[model samples]
Target: MTTNTEPALHKSLGTLQLWGIAVGLVISGEYFGWSFGWASAGTLGFMVTAIFIAAMYACFIFSFTELTTSIPHAGGPFEYSRRAFGPVGGYLAGFATLVEFVFAPPAISLAIGAYLNVQFPALDPKIAALGAYLVFMGLNIVGVQIAATFELFVTLVAIFELLVFMGVVSPGFSVANFVKGGWSGEDAFSLASVPGMFAAIPFAIWFFLAIEGVAMAAEEARDPKRSIPIAYIAGILTLVVLAIGVMLFAGGAGDWTQLANINDPLPQAMKLIVGDNSGWLHMLVWLGLFGLIASFHGIILGYSRQIFALSRAGYLPELLGRVHPKFRTPHLAILAGGIVGIAAIFSDELITFGGQTLTANIVTMSVFGAIVMYILSMASLFKLRATEPGLPRSFRAPGFPVVPGFALLAAVVCLVAMTYYNPLIAGVFVGLMALGYLYFLATRSRRAVRAATAV
Candidate 1:
């Protein structure tokens, strides 16, 4: 196993490229997952839910930037928690990050399959999904610069497509369409809709799900101290605007119920505006693939770093951390994540007790992971602020204790809310974490014994 850490990755990313990395990590999110919120809460309720979630993320990102710049490590939340709370905390943080970064790609990969099928009706979506995994993983393994440059290109395309979507749908956007009958077909908001609004939190979170992933790339950044703040602030602004715009337009474009649970909400929304065979629908569907591709390729890059950092620190098998001799990338880790994602795509038809699709179940499980990481990371930030008072921070979170506290509280609420709404999905996630922690325990003791014996 190659454990050398002196030169693990090429240091070539700048502010613009980092912006690409951050934006690309989550642009696909704006296209699909958030609409699932509408299924439970309807358009207006989901919109209200989205606004709160967006505020939580805004606070989270500001706090996370301080952690990234102060530590400047590829381990992200893992590194931050390890410093503040020790080994067990590190494992939980790392495992949550792995779940967040690794599982997200499968969801995006499935969307890629759905988007491709729009153009090629004969192609099997399963094959297309697996094909997306193989192709993007290969690109990431080649080199970070190439992968990042490609990310920038596709992100720009995705951004332009969003602008075009908003323009095309704006003429047809009626506030009445978005708000009227938007409360799950009920006359008005009631006590019963409270659970639904909470249930919608996870889907609303999808709008900016992995943008904090920029922190994972800090170790490879040319000037993470300065660039990190710029990347994060700019990245969140981009997403917030995009999220609100897309959600409002998508909801207002048609019979909001038709879009609540689908994989490709944008194309469907456009079809409603322009009819079944509009030339606009065909163009948007093709360009929309860029949005999905941006997130897929960027996340593979982020998860590889998460894997590399953990394995190198002995949290996982050292071989999984091995850097490619020529490419200087975590090739094994990339392939491992890819294999698991391909497996998920194949098993995408499973159902939860709530009759949610495997994709919905997986989405809930991934949100659980994000919630865990957010709570820990925010706590780490609060702890570090008190303990490491003079840690030479380049960027400080805006409201200090208040901001991190709000983020922590918001994350805790989301965690409890989602678990209450989706008990089966919650149980499955807890079981998975238990299995991983067991592996960690066995390996940690074995390593200690080996060290003592060597003496």
Candidate 2:
């Protein structure tokens, strides 16, 4: 008697899906919060932080391009690690990543709720949060094709919204805003506040946090080796340019303080510049909302798939491994992810890595998880290359061991820096990772026992 192996299902994401993940992760709702951090950093600090963040992201993308092309499987980093380092390493990489994605949607949904609350004081955060989850959950559960289409629409609108804000608000910007003092308190111009600039660098770092989604989408990309590299390079360059444009536009506007405080700074900046009488600001607001929604959908798509992939590999429960028969989607995992976001309504408010004053507890948790996963993935790259030089690389990271080496170093530095600055929330992240690793060890012991019994 022989056992039959399960057949594998493949995803061939087109340019649209490719852009969906790329733009979605880069042009995030997180930016709304990031602007405050950048403004507080002042011009030079902002520029420096932006460069550091961009370079780090480039390294990650380049490294992932190599790994993604080789495996080109659904597991993303999880699959790459399993192939290179075996099951335990894969589990850790995948587990850390799952924690991030599972918890992130709620944080993003909370952002939507927070923004909606600004316009509608009566809008309950919970209700708005739940609504956001349903819309995106439905999109994911329905299928990737529909989700991809929706993401395309949302990203397009987001681009238009950003362009409109930039075009309309340019004339209203005052150079004086850039020179204002105490960017954090009114002492920004004071030499004593120099630390504030260093404090502000993390904000830029936070903006570039999720830019790795393009490489993560390797499993679904139409051509992993080719598409992954193109998406990684083109997507990042486009986003960095856009980010610089937004920063310059904001800096040029007279009162950085005003932009820093507003929930949706671009629309408010447009209002301040062009006057509230213009209907375009409202249109831009709606478009911006659409952009946020698009971001929401894209993350859910990518994150849920990450979970499904890991689950299929036996690192998670099989339920998460199920693909909807009709929709060809990860229904259970998508639902599970949305539920976490829905639960985040009850969680505390937590400050984000960006200099922003606050974010939902869930979002902060996800950000921390993402950071941890990045560190793991980068380290894995270094370890795998050293341990398995003979392995074929369809795409190679430029600068040899230097690229992966630097990425690992950057990951360590950022983690330490983020922890130093935001110990409170950062502590929470550490706690979660500790708990996850423990669970990993526990499960492994049980599996070992089972294997022995079978023998």
Q: Write the per-residue lDDT of candidate 1 for residues 236-326, one digit (tens) a residue.
A: 9999999999988988897888887788889999988898788898888889999999999999999889998888677888788788999
- In the range 126-219, model 2's lDDT, one tens digit per residue, is 6887898887788778767666767777777777777777887777766666555424455345564555555554556555656565555565
Kindly report which residue pairs in candidate 2 clash with one another.
106-341, 173-253, 174-253, 174-254, 177-254, 181-188, 182-186, 182-187, 182-188
Q: Backbone clash tally for model 2? A: 9
Cα lDDT, all candidates: 0.87, 0.66
lDDT of 2: 0.66
Q: Which candidate is the best by lDDT?
A: 1
TM-score of 1: 0.96
Off by over 4 Å in 2: 1-10, 29-31, 38-44, 83-88, 182-194, 349-363, 445-455
How close is every model to the real structure, measured as TM-score?
A: 0.96, 0.88
RMSD for all candidates, in order, please: 2.3, 3.7
